[model samples]
Target: MLPAHRLPHLLSQAVDLQVSRCPYHFEPHPPSFSSQIRYSLLTDHLCPRSEFPSETVHILTAHSDEVWFLVFSHDGSRLASGAKDGEIILWDMKGESPKVQHKMRGQTDGIAHLAWSPDDSLLLSCGREDCPGAIVFNTQSGEVKCRVQNSAEDSLTCGAWSPDGQHFYVGGTRGQFLECALDGSVSSSWEGIRVNALAAHSSPRSVYAADTHCRIRRYNFQDMSYDNLIEEDHSIMSFTVSRSGRNALLNVANQGVHVWDLNDRCLVRRCHGVTQGHYTIHSCYGGLNDSFIASGSEDGNVYVWRSGKEKPALVLRGHSRTVNCVAWNPVYPTTLASASDDGTVRVWGKEKAALRQRQLAAASEPTGITGNGDVSESTSERRGELGGGGVGGLATSASSLASEQLDESLSAASLAEVGSDWQLAVDSLTSSMDSSVGVQPLSLPSLSSRPLPPPSDQLPADEEDEDQVTGSISTEV
Candidate 1:
């Protein structure tokens, strides 16, 4: 016994309330037939989807020898890689496919390390014994703009350009750390225990040098004095500071990588299982927002571990020999590059259609039919029916209709019209299921359409005795 005006308003309120509460209590009742169909469609839309795993997108293989060091310019447009064959290759990464833009030959022995100037106009390279101590070259022209020679017999281990790009810090195998100008003139020299690695920090205006004696010393350019930052049990071969400069990743020789909190001056995390037996392998931070750490393994694979996770997230197999270095493109977060003794740099990313196929495959596992025997078909046939565009087409049409209806005013008349159209659309969909015409079984796109290369082409597991030499410039006085 409701008033005419109150009845319509009350009915609308009841409908909205029921619609809002339906999703919470919409569990399928096996005891009912219509309920099962509703449940299947609802679950298909509501179920959480899994993400696709990243895969290799490209492989760069221009270096004949093992690639040792890789550094991307600040702008992330160019990547300079130094190989053991005394060659530095500049790759232009701005294109669809990474292309080798220039190749600069280093000394006969090889290029040990490479550092780009802050302005990306110059590149500093260190070489092995018998090669020049340090060379500052024009990045655009690959011309040796300046050369620093401490001694004819001295070998350079690591080098870093100052924040201002006016000076250079070059470490030698003979425990000699020399600060030189852009013109290769030595400004100052610090005689210390064998310096293995050097890193420059801009905020604090300091340079960090790791020595063979298991200690890291921070040298302040302001005071021109050095203070010990960290002292561990194992000899530190090389280290990379985090982008924030609040943490440092130290490569402890024979041991795994260790993360040190620069702010608190304490050990944060230890990423182990990266086999480091006879040589020094580099580690880098990558993944979304540098939340993961990637490193080379002596077992001929690339290992990636989340920041807090103890176990590695993925052990990528590609390198036939030791993976000497791993670099993530700064611009493209998904793109990763790994250098190996196999003389190749492989790029890893995700494929789109493969992702969709995986999603469809996972969705097909849950039985969409009810126990009422309305559909007596095998799972494969059911999958084919779904893939043939029945459910997808229905969903698309329903969504389009809903959107078109929603575009109009949400008055009572409009709502009634929309409800009528929706009921008719559902009825039409159900009727179409009785006939096979225009029904394409739901199936993934043919794998042959965009087939991936064979596994052998992606990750070569055969280990040939390639002359693998430690490109680390370690000179013992």
Candidate 2:
């Protein structure tokens, strides 16, 4: 009885769930091959995310202005970045060093976001209100294909290409929602709510948009109908959809990143530890099989979290200013890229040399890794002190004591396992699974867990929310 559009979306979610592709699922005893891999993420991963992309391999400084957004191509072979100075730099990521494949310039002001077509043949870029021009570029040749300008009265703010690659959906601050073809033609247009972000779904033939008022809604083009997906107390900054199109990650003002189950239409998890007060922070679904989540923080750090948990499993520090965007390589599980207000883009991944150095350091420690693959008093104490105090009261050192964290010998194998297929990794995951026999991912008790407060319909109390960092513009259009 479901519509044709709805059937495709439902099937995709069912397949993704049946395969146990999401490591965040809270099943007690999952019987799928992916379940074994889930435990690998929790147990095989060490503090500081030992095998994760903790080392910065490349630092790109071509932009004279602060970088606003970053996105990896569908093939994961190239990365494109946009900056406040209106330049788009494409980097070839296949080499030992990421070199500038092409430098594109079109807009006069900042570039708010970038999108790569599903075929990887073209790029759609949304500009700030100062310029209000959307440009489509031929990715292979770095040539401008077409340009779509805003109306004299209002400007476009966000865009995303549809699954069929014929046209894209764009939204404006003044509620101009339209479908535009690549040839600089408008296919269809509508008057919708003011939008801050846009994501397109092919299966359901729908578009999901987040407005400045902290509300998310879905618009089905076929039926010309809409439904509410999420409503938060704080203003929404950005939204990232999962590969399966079943989940979304939202970066909100004053609140940290949140994970929402699109199928269930509920806030599943609120990633904590790190905080955000202002500006749009973009987050993504990454890691092997999209089991892990990563987000750029307003505090200049990149946080990585296990999908099921609320607290970040690892915090990466290095950026000197707010890290506005992050992208993980879809092909290479270990590689990650982050853009910052400090006018630089940094690449991170597992480094064998650094792994060797850590191995030597851990080998020399007086209290080294124990037989059970757990770190000794030295490392455990540091984690304990950090996770000691509770939100209100009680202890939460389960992360420190619940599992053995650092074992140098496990680095190479874990990195390989991270990128391995569940079918092929069954043996390795089961072997390491035995070592983590008793170590379980911690969950807060019901007595201590608090339900989300009812959402308020009032505007955000932060008086400067409108002026401080909304799209780097002085005022909303």
Candidate number achieving the greatest TM-score relative to the actual structure: 2
Candidate 1: where is the Cα deviation over 4 Å?
Answer: 1-53, 129-132, 203-205, 353-440, 443-477
What are the Cα lDDT values of the candidates? 0.63, 0.67
All candidates' TM-scores?
0.65, 0.67
Ten-residue region with minimum lDDT total, candidate 1: 468-477
lDDT of 1 by residue, 9-108 (tens): 6544544433323211122223333233333221122211112124444456678888887877877898888889888988887644466777898756
Model 1 TM-score, all chains together: 0.65
Q: Name the candidate that leads on lDDT.
A: 2
Q: What does candidate 2's lDDT look like per residue over 243-264, in tens digits?
A: 8888999998888888899889
